[model samples]
Target: MRKIVHIDMDAFYASVEQRDDPSLRGRPVVVAWRGKRSVVCAASYEARRFGVRSAMPAITAERLCPEAVFVPPDFGRYKAVSRQVREIFLRHTDLVEPLSLDEAYLDVTRNKTGLPTATRVAKTIRQQIRDETQLNASAGVAPAKFLAKIASDWKKPNGLFVIQPHEVLDFLAPLSVARIPGVGKVMEAKLARYGIRSVGDLRSWDIFELERRFGRYGLRLHELAHGIDHSEVKPDRPVQSISAEDTFDIDRFRDELGPAIRQLAEKAWQATRKTERLARTVVLKLKTDQFKIYTRSITPGDSINNVDEVSALALLLLQRVELPADTRYRLVGVGLSNFYEPGQLGGQTELFGNEF
Candidate 1:
């Protein structure tokens, strides 16, 4: 059995902001740009009490917590802190897989520190992070990555939780199907219609029946319900895509999306600058007021060069939207994908298409 440990920093970006500014400590802080179209990057625990959360509209965050302090995100400082945290992880194990700036999975099955158990390794790492960086991290130790991810969030905010190999089935039984990764509201409701509300209920169904109903995903559901996950903790996973999206306060016609698309394109383009990889494809995503999603993509002959190029191509993709003129959209997104290394861009063919 694998001994996996998942570490999650508590409100990482906001915590860093608070740690740097003593006056901001103990106050509700929302990390985001100051604008009507801006979405929150992170919220301090104090802000969470007021129902503020990441990816929420900044206007909505202000409405929810009128007294909250809004700070712009400082990725430079956050990345520095993240590097410190990663150094702490390396002290315990080399098999670390970072999910984002704030969370990671470590396979401590054979730790470098000679820790007696994965739980000890996790505890030590969390303590080291606290002592070195003055940051609190929650950790979960389990025999599998999915369960470890879930356990990390169970107690949350500088807490630790462990799931023993023998206790996996019992631990998962009563949990809602939504607790399983990838089981979103749509899938949950579909499962609920078939009397599958909990992991235990999903376990009772035959694998064949599940596959017949939900296709390939049903097979995955069956395996997870039985406490079986074969996925390994892959370290140093490369970035697959980068994107930014926004939902508007009022539904808008397709023609009205230019400003928002440009804004999101700028955000996405800025994100791409942080990586050495080049993106060949530009994707534009739109969600109708009715919640139907459509995506249009284009691959230029060369990698994108600047925010202006991203904005121009994204706007061009917007022209490809075939939805009715009367159709109003509630959300739009801009993304860059089809990554290539610096020397690998020659002989690339331009491509364009739309996906449902």
Candidate 2:
């Protein structure tokens, strides 16, 4: 069994703010942008007690936690701290998979520190992050990614949990099906129809029957139910797509959509530069005032590079949208897909698509 550890920063953005400003410590903090359309990027544990959460609209978060202090996101500083944390991971193992600035998976089966176990490696990494960044991190060590991710959350805000391979099934059985990877609200509802609400309930179903009902995902459900996840931790997993989107406070007319599209395209381009791959498809996503979502995409003969080129291409895609006249849009997104690694660009042929 491969030994994997998941490390997640606790209230990352809020913690950073508190670390920089002494007065902010021990207070409820919400990290978010200001303005009508703004959504929270993170919430402190104190703010969470009032039911505020990340991704909640800033306005709603304010309503939920009237006393919460709002702070704007600082990706630059967050990225710097993230780099420091990653350096700590590299000290233990080369197989580090960063899920985001605040979280990562490390395969420490052959750790460099000569730690006797993955749990000890996780403890060392957490301590280093605390000692260096003055921030809290949660850790989980397990035989697989899904379990490790779940275990990481078992204890929050500076905690560590471990799942031995021999105890996997017992640990998973009583948990809600919602705890399973990829089993979201929709999947949970579908599973509920079959009287399957927990991992134990899911284990009773036949794999063939599950495959018949849920298709490929059903096979995965069966494997997870049996506490089996064969997937390995992939380091620096290849980038498939880079995207950025905005929600407008007021509905925007079609002719008024240029500014939003351009902004999102620039943001997406900045994200694209972080990857070693090139993008061939320029995609435009929009949501109408009625909440109807639509996407338009094109694979140009040339890979996308600059902001002007991508923004212009995305604007052209808007002309192709055949929404009824007077249909105002509430959101706009810019994305680049169909990625090709540098070496593969020589004979570059497009693969279907993948989600990042």
For each candidate, give its TM-score against the true structure: 0.85, 0.78
Off by over 4 Å in 1: 243-253, 256-280, 286-294, 299-312, 322-333, 340-356
TM-score of 1: 0.85
The C-alpha local distance difference test score for the whole of candidate 2 amounts to 0.84
Question: Candidate 2, residues 143-219: lDDT per residue as tens digits?
Answer: 99999999999999799999998899999999999999999877999999999998999999999999999999999
lDDT (tens digit, per residue) of candidate 1 on 125-204: 88899999999999988888899999999998889999998889999999999999899877999999999999999999
Highest TM-score against the true fold, candidate = 1
Clashing pairs in 1: none
lDDT for each candidate structure: 0.85, 0.84
Report the lDDT of model 1 for residue 169: 98
Worst 10 residues of 1 by lDDT: 347-356
